[model samples]
Target chain A: MRIGDLAARTGVSVRSLRYYEEQGLLDSSRSPGGHRHYDEEGVDRVAYLQRLYAAGLSSQTILSLLPCLESPSAATSDSAFDRLVEERDKLVTHIAGLTRTLESLDELITLNRKRRAASVADPDSGEPGRTTQG
Target chain B: MRIGDLAARTGVSVRSLRYYEEQGLLDSSRSPGGHRHYDEEGVDRVAYLQRLYAAGLSSQTILSLLPCLESPSAATSDSAFDRLVEERDKLVTHIAGLTRTLESLDELITLNRKRRAASVADPDSGEPGRTTQG
Candidate 1:
């Protein structure tokens, strides 16, 4: 498919696709008319790239780690696999932290809802203030 | 506390704290001697800002949403709180996707470890290829 098709399929802008190619995070072949063409694999590859970027991994780190993600069974050294495991551990820690944040948000939202309800029930009670959570 | 102290307390770089202030995602007061001073509230504020950044929220979006996060019970219009809930919902979706990726990585790691153990047991089984998982 052409660049436009890839962009439409992935929901990424054409400029970002080109930037990914330039950063070596993606690849394309030129057509007979010199337009960029991406194969079917490009779809999943772009999706993976987007996930890593969303996780706050730099393009450089993602580029370095792509091999571990792309090839699961090609004979890599134990140390290489170890590094990938380390990266995974980092992700685990990150996920845990985000989970905590989500919980905090949930608590705050619940408290606000209750307060809002009370205020609605009794308009003369003065405005309910922000919940002070440490 | 001073900028450096805040950086130390929050584990964020002093430069990044300055950047956050410049982006309007954080605020600091200046002492009479012209040095930036941050209050106790700045600690949690910086931590929250960092988490938002890690979750891929741009500074602009975070700046706009700060009020919702900072004040849970202050009388915000229904629309304002609705926008915050929308953002939280987005984070929930992102967390779900990352969980899937983490699971995928776990499977790949397990497969690779099994393959490595098998190769160790029999050096002449011909190279085991990647597990073809769709």
Candidate 2:
């Protein structure tokens, strides 16, 4: 498949695909006409790259882990396992932070709902806000 | 306060602070000698910007939503609320995606652990892998 088709299939931009190739996370052989050609497994490889990128791994880190992930049957080094554990820990932290943000957003949404409800309930009182005049 | 001080206090890089200023998410004044200067309130504003960025809102979206977040007591337009709701939905999606990734990572870790345990249990059998020879 051509690079364009791979990009279209993966929903990743051509520029990003090129960057992934440059970063050594992806590979594409050049055809006789010098056009980039991807193998049949390119789609799965791109998807895997997307997952690792989405998990907040840097290109460098992904480059290191890509081989290990691709060949799960192969004996993985302790360092690779450590890096995976580190990445898992980072994901845990990101999830926790996002959960806190979600909680705050929920509180804000609830507050807004109550304020809107108050506005509807007391149309005469232009100021039915929670903040009391000090 | 100088940009360095703000960077140190906020834990955001000086380069990023400048980028945020360029993106209109932050503001700073230049001194007589042309050094960047931040007010006392700049710290809080930068922290707020950090939270929004961490929530995965782009700088453009942050610029639009910053005013409403800064003034929660003031009247927020319906569109602002809609944008906030949209951002909240995005955050939810991101959290869900990360959660799924975390589950996969956990599974990989478990599989690796099991492989290691099996290898220990069967020292004579060089091939303790899950993959069966076809």
Candidate 1 residue-wise lDDT at A28:
91
The candidate maximizing TM-score is 1
- The fraction of reference A/B contacts recovered in model 2 reads 0.19
DockQ of each: 0.42, 0.25
Question: Candidate 2 — which pairs collide?
Answer: none
| Model 1 CA deviation exceeding 4 Å by range | A28-30, A124-127, A131-134, B22-29, B124-127, B130-134
What is residue A60's positional error in candidate 2, in angstroms?
A: 1.0
Clashing pairs in 1: none
- Give me the candidate number with maximum DockQ: 1
lDDT of 2: 0.74
What TM-score does each of the candidates earn? 0.83, 0.75
Question: On residues B1-134, what C-alpha lDDT tens digit does candidate 2 reach at each position?
Answer: 99999999999999999999999877789999988999888887787677777878799997776544544432656677678778889889889888887887777776666665666776544433442100
What lDDT tens digits, residue by residue, belong to model 2 across residues A1-134?
99999999999999999999999988889999989999878887887678778878899998776544654432666677678778889999988988887777766666665665666666544433441101
| Candidate 1 docking band | acceptable
